[model samples]
Target chain A: MTDYIVPVLLFAACAVALRKKENAYDLMLLGAKDGLKLLVSLIPTLILLLTAVTMLRASGAMEMLSRFFAPAFSVLGIPPETAILVLVRPISGSAALALGADLMAQYGVDSLVGQTAAVMLGSTETTFYTISVYFGAAGIKKTRYTLPAALIADITGFVVASLTVRLFL
Target chain B: MVMSWIFTGLLALSLFASLVLGNGSALAAAVPQGARDGVNLVLSIAGSICLWSGVGKLMEVVGFTGFLSKLLSPLLHRLFPSTRQDKDLGQSLSANVCANFLGLGNAATPMGIQAAQRLAKRSEGIASDELCRLIVLNTASIQLLPANVAAVRVSLGCQTPFDILPAVWITSLCSASLGLCAAWLLGKVWRR
Candidate 1:
């Protein structure tokens, strides 16, 4: 969060410092306006994610799926709670965040599951949603190498998350 | 439009899948509930994502991006040394990088657009830098520690919510490194 504060100021400073008097105020205003549009565009997406996550938790997918995933992860030293994270990480980023929060709450952050979720958070990409929004917005009809590449990166993150937590936790 | 439709359909499919997975014997009875719940879930997630996106934009308005640029300047220089100084592309890259790190991805959308705008200017309509390259770069794997993730850990009542240092460092290091390498390779191929 500390890293976040100054960048907001950078927009105004960059506009004021770099642009002419005529352009400075104008560009900043345009940016501000576009910023709002950007925000507005994402509402439906967020609402959908939250609803799905809540429903899943209510549905007992959290408990049932954890059992299935626990044995698989034991080989990697990851606790089962972290399994829910890997499940949601791909489909919905917000859900994953919520799930991680729940895991943190019950298991405690010092626990291996909590630690693994933290690492997993930083490591992986939000594959389906990001691909859809980014490329869809750009009118990119095809991803070509992008899909495989993103997956490889995701696998690497999963492995590293497990390995690091196992070694350190 | 096609992609959107596909995604919507997939959401529906995932919902059905969840319903069946949960209620194999009572599929007909449960399907409707699952469908309604799934739609509601998607809507909620959409709202939250928009909220975070709004916050991220507010972040830009208040000048948080510039500071992030300076702070992450060293890493940016090392990662993408080819990017020029005094260019918004670098700033945009830094912004995207920062958003990814915070797991404020919906927020990173604007930064990606900004970076693309900069890249477009740098290429001067030559298509030399092709659009996908920016996407790949923006999609770079990030390393998050004391983030929404740590908050989750804390809420879950973990002893140390910030106990993910090892995983954060190692996983992010590998994923981001691989992302950069593959992206660079793809960029080279595109250039040819």
Candidate 2:
């Protein structure tokens, strides 16, 4: 079902273009070029972020911090084991993916903890990364209430993810 | 300013922790490994991003994005009142949300940035309420497919990866709704 979505969307777009007698091929090339430019501009930020997060993970700081936060998080129905995932998720996407993969591996993927971790990963975004990139591009110096609100949302996602998995999965 | 602090703090804290935990060597190795991984990640997504961007351009030319904007206008009009007066911004926001819903992170970012730029025009170097709300919307993760999570589950030997869809949906809806409400409430309070 999910696999069909992409192809279906593409087909619809192409059909529309043809009906409108638009030069679809040339426009696609132009957009692709713009995409390449966008990726090039994003490279530095992505590399720096990934490096810092990887260092933190490799040095075991994430594990240590997760251990400290485990009790608090457990009160919210999040298991102690997935504490690192919840922590890393808001800051880094790849790091969170790695942590989620590790959780599913350590516990069987069918286990409650693993299922909860997956749901959490699926439901939440990398808050810090999104905030920084979007605001930075807009040259907004004062983020005002964005960070607090985003963090609140993230916490809501994490807590609800655990509960949903527990009740449904 | 905040981003700078976060980047520096992440590096400083990691270095301090590595020295104390006797994992300095691992930390050293991870830096280059991570840089390589970042490049690889970009390369891996490049094809899809280009493809989607191309398709998105076609959609734009054919006015499909306008149709999408209208389709979602009732909710969007409230969330982004500026969209009612600014057609371009509305199209960009709709495109971004559509890409995000399909879990196309690469395609979403450019469109999101475009929308953000337009929103920023009304502010004086500070994020307006609408701009902040847009950021919140993006950060709340409203993806419907969650393909990446399902793939990871499949690799981990889960027979039915999509079984968690209901849980994902519930969590996403809850988070996005709560996040938007929090942003709106905070905006109201801060204005006082």
Q: Would you list the C-alpha lDDT of every candidate in the order shown?
A: 0.57, 0.81
For the predicted complex of model 2, DockQ is 0.52
TM-score versus the correct structure, for each prediction: 0.59, 0.72
- For residue B18, model 2's alpha carbon misses the true position, in angstroms, by 12
Q: Give model 2's docking category.
A: medium
Q: Give me the displacement of residue A64 in model 1, in angstroms.
A: 4.8
The digit string of per-residue lDDT tens for model 1 on B8-32 reads 6434544565676765444343445
Best candidate per DockQ, number?
2
Q: What is the per-residue lDDT of model 2 for residues A99-153, given as tens digits with 9 covering 90 to 100?
A: 6765676678999989998999999999998998999999999899999999999
Scoring each candidate complex against the real one, what DockQ results?
Answer: 0.20, 0.52
Q: Judged by lDDT, which candidate is best?
A: 2
> What is the per-candidate TM-score for chain B?
0.57, 0.68
